[model samples]
Target: MVNSIKCLLLLSLAFVPFCHCKKEQGVNLYPQFYDQSCPKAQEIVKSIVAKAFAKDPRMAASLLRLHFHDCFVKGCDGSVLLDSSGTIISEKRSNPNRNSARGFEVIDEIKSAIEKECPHTVSCADILAIAARDSTVLTGGPSWGVPLGRRDSLGASLSGSNQNIPAPNNTFQTILTKFKLKGLDIVDLVALSGSHTIGDSRCTSFRQRLYNQTGNGKADFTLDQSYAAKLRTQCPRSGGDQNLFVLDFVTPVKFDNNYFKNLLAFKGLLSSDEILLTDNKESEDLVKKYAERNDLFFEQFAKSMVKMGNITPLTGSRGEIRRICRRINN
Candidate 1:
C-alpha cells in the first residue's frame, strides 16, 4: 500500500509518463499493464528491491546496470540473467560482463516473490526495467513510470554482449556508435552515463589510465595526477584486477551531477568516463551542462531511461515470461 502510493506519487510527477499510451515497435508498454493480471506487481517489486538495497547499498547501481547490460545485448530481453546450461552461452561470461555484472541473486529473489504473488505474469525483462527505476529512486534519484510488458529471451548472446556493450577504454566514437546502434543518441549517452554517480568500477577497468594510457608506458595525462596517484595505491600496476573503487569519489552513493563534475576535474575513475569530456564536441558540451544543472540531468535521465527501456522489447505473443529468470521455461 505504501509502495503503491509512492508509485502514484512518483508517476504523477512532471517527469514520468502520464498514461498507458506510449508505443514502441507498434506495441504499447504502460505502467498499468499488470493492473488486471497482477495488481500488486509494482508494489511487490518495489518492496523487495528496497529491502535488497537496504542490505547492500551497491545493489541499487548493480540492478540499474543489469537493465543496461540486458537491453544492450538483445533488446532488453533479460538474456544477461541466464546461467550457462545446455547450449545457452550466458552473457555473464562475456568480456564486458565477466566478473562485473552483478545483482543476479537480488533479481532471483524478486522473481521468486513475484511468482508467488503473480505467477509468471511479469517478464524478467520488465522486472529488470522496473528494478532499475526503483533502484534509482532508492538512491535519491529521479523516478519515472517504467513502461512494462517486455518478455524474456530464450537464448543468451555472448558475442553480442562482448561486441555491443561499450568497454572502459573504448574511444568516444566507439561508445557513441554502440549507443547509436541501440537507438540512443548523445543526450541519452550523457544522461545515462550519469548513473555512474552511484556505482563502483574495478581496478582493471581503469588501471590503464593510471599506468599506461597511450601504450607508451606513461600514465594518462588527462587524469588528475594526484587522483591517479591515490588510485595507484590500491590498483597497483597489475594483479589487483578486482579491487573496487567508487566511480564518483565525491558522492559515491548519491545520484547527482558529481559524475559529470568529476569528469570536468579529470578525476573520473574510468577512461570511458573521462573521454565523455575530452573526446567529442557534443558529448563534451553535455557533460558541461549536466555538471552545472542537476535538475536538467535528472529530467533528461528519466527521459533517457524510458527511451532505452523501449529498445525492441517483445510484446504481444513474441516472448515468454520465464518461471525462472536464470533459464527459459520448460
Candidate 2:
C-alpha cells in the first residue's frame, strides 16, 4: 500500500489518476487521487472546457453552475448528470434545473476524451468539479487545486434537486439556511455567491424583484430604478420569462468582485444577491470586504469552493465509476 501510494504520488507530480457514503464526509478526495490511475483526467477536462468556452464565452458560467447544482442535489455524486431511466428520476427535470442547468454536452465531450485515455478510471462528479475550476480560470477568476475521487451515483434525485437548490427569490435567511444545511456557513454563502460574477439569470428568476417585489407590485426598493428600468426593457412586466440577463452588469463575462460591487450599488440582478448586504450584518460586511478588496474576495472564494466541493462526496467502494455520465453501466 505504501509503495502504491508512493507511485501514485510520484506520477501525480507529473502525469495521472469510488461508489458510497461513508460517514457523509469527503475525506477520500484529494487532488492527486487520479495521479496514477488517470494522469490525464484533469488535462482532458481542462482542454474540453477551454474549447467550449472559446466557442461560447457564456459556456464558462454554464459549466461552473453545473458543478454547483450537481453538488447541492446529491453530495457531488453526478446525480444531476443522469437522464431519466428505469426507476431513475433525473434531477435535470427538477424545478431549479429544468430550464436553467446546462452544459451536459460539454461534459459529454470531456468524459469521452478522458475515456479514450483512461477508460472508467475517473468519475463524472470529478469531471464536473475540474470543469468548474477550469471554467473559472478561463473567465479570469482565481483557481485552486480541486480535490477529486468522488464517485458517480447510481440514482438521481429529482425531489432532492428541487428541494435543496436555493432559489433566486428566496429570503436571505432561507438562502443562508440552505447553505448551512449543506455544512456551509455565511462565509461560504457569501464567497460562493461570488459566482454570480459570471453567469446569466433568466427573466423569470428575478422578475419578482422588478415588478412585484413582496407582492406589493413595487419594484424591490433595493434595486436601482435605472438598472431595473433597463432590465424591464428586456424582462418586461409579463412574458419574456426565458429572456436572459447578465448577473454582473459591469463585467458580464469576467469572474471578479464586480458582483459584490453591484450589490452595493443596488444594481444586483437577483433579490437573493441584494439581500446579502441589506438583510444580514455579517453578510453585509462580507459584501463590503469583497467589493473593496478583490484579493480578499478571491482568497475566500477559493477556500469556499474547496469546502463546497468537499460536501458528502462518495468514496471508497460506495459508488461506481460510471461508464457513461448520463446513465449507469450496463
Candidate 3:
C-alpha cells in the first residue's frame, strides 16, 4: 500500500508541470497580464491617449484605425509600427498606409511613458490594443477589457499591408473576402467597418465616385447628388487629392451609427462604405439594423473590436516586448 501511494504521488507531480506547460505554450493573453509585472501599464497608455485626443479630437479615430491596420497585416504583432531599417521595409509606405495611416507619434509618446514606468516590460502590441479601447470610450463608444501580453514583431510586411488591408475602392466581395481570410465573418466586417464613424478619408480615396465610378464620365448614382456636389467643391477633379473629408458627416467626431444612417441615405463617403447598403443583402440588413439601434451597434462594435484584437498574437517568448514602438529592440 505504501509503495502504490508513492507511485501515484509521482504520477500526479509529473502531471502538474505538464498542465502548467500547456498553459504557457498556448495563447496566453488576458486583461490582467501586467497586473503584477507592471500594474500601471494600462493606466499609462490611457493617459497618453487622452492627452493626444484632447490635443486633436480626430486623433482618437486615427489611433483606432492604426490598431485595425496593424492587426490585419501581421496579426496585431506591431509590425505596422516598425520603421524602415537594415532589412525591414516599413508598412507605413504601403498603398493603404502611405499618406493615410497616422498616430505613430502618439504611440511613441505612450511607449516612452510605459518604458519609464517599466522598461522593456509592456509590449507595443498591447499598447495599441489598450489605446484603441480608450479612444473608442473617449469618443462616446462602448469599451471592452482588452486582453494584453501580445509581443512585437521583429519585422514589417509591406506586401501584407498592401494586400491584406482593404482599399477604399475595393469591391464589396473583395473587402468581405479580406476579412474572411482573417477569420472574420460578414457580421464582423460590417461592425468593424463602423470605425468609419469617427475617421476622415482623403478626397482621392473616393473622388472617382464623384466623377467616374465605373471608368465612365457619369457619377456614381448610388451617392446622393447633393452630398456629391458638396464633396466636389472641396475634393475637385484636379488638385485636391490630399484634402480631407469626414467619413461620417453627421457625427464627424463622434463614434455613432450615423455612418450607417448616411449609408441608408446614400451618402456614404467611400465605395466600400456604400457597398454595405448596395451590394450584399446580408450586409444591407446589418446596416439597417445598426442604424435603427445604436445600442446594438455599440454592443456588436465592442465585441468585433475585441475579436479583431485577438488575431494571431506572438506571446510566450515568441516575440519581444519592443522598447521603442518604432524599432526592434537591440
Model 2, 48-122: lDDT tens per residue?
Answer: 899999889999999888899998887899999999999998999998899888899999988888899999999
CA-lDDT, candidates in order: 0.91, 0.91, 0.93
Q: Residue 282, candidate 1: how far off, in angstroms?
A: 1.0
| Cα-based lDDT at residue 293, candidate 2 | 97
Q: How do the predictions measure up, each by TM-score?
A: 0.91, 0.91, 0.92
Which candidate has the top score in lDDT?
Answer: 3
Q: For residues 162-249, write the lDDT of model 3, one tens digit per residue.
A: 9999999999999999999988999999999998999899988998998884555567999999989889889887788889999999
Q: How many collisions per candidate?
A: 0, 14, 0
Model 1 ranges off by over 4 Å:
1-25, 213-217
TM-score of 2: 0.91
Q: Pick the candidate with the highest TM-score.
A: 3
List model 1 lDDT by residue over 1-330, tens digit each. Answer: 999999888878845453433433255788899999988888888999999988999999999999999999989999999999999999999988998889999889989999999898999999999999999999999999998888888899999999999999999999999999999999999999999999899999988888784555567978999998888889988698999999999998888899999999999888899999998899999999999999999999999999999998888898799999999997
C-alpha displacement of 116 in model 2, angstroms?
0.8
Q: How much is the lDDT of residue 62 in candidate 2? A: 91
Native-structure RMSD, model 1: 8.9
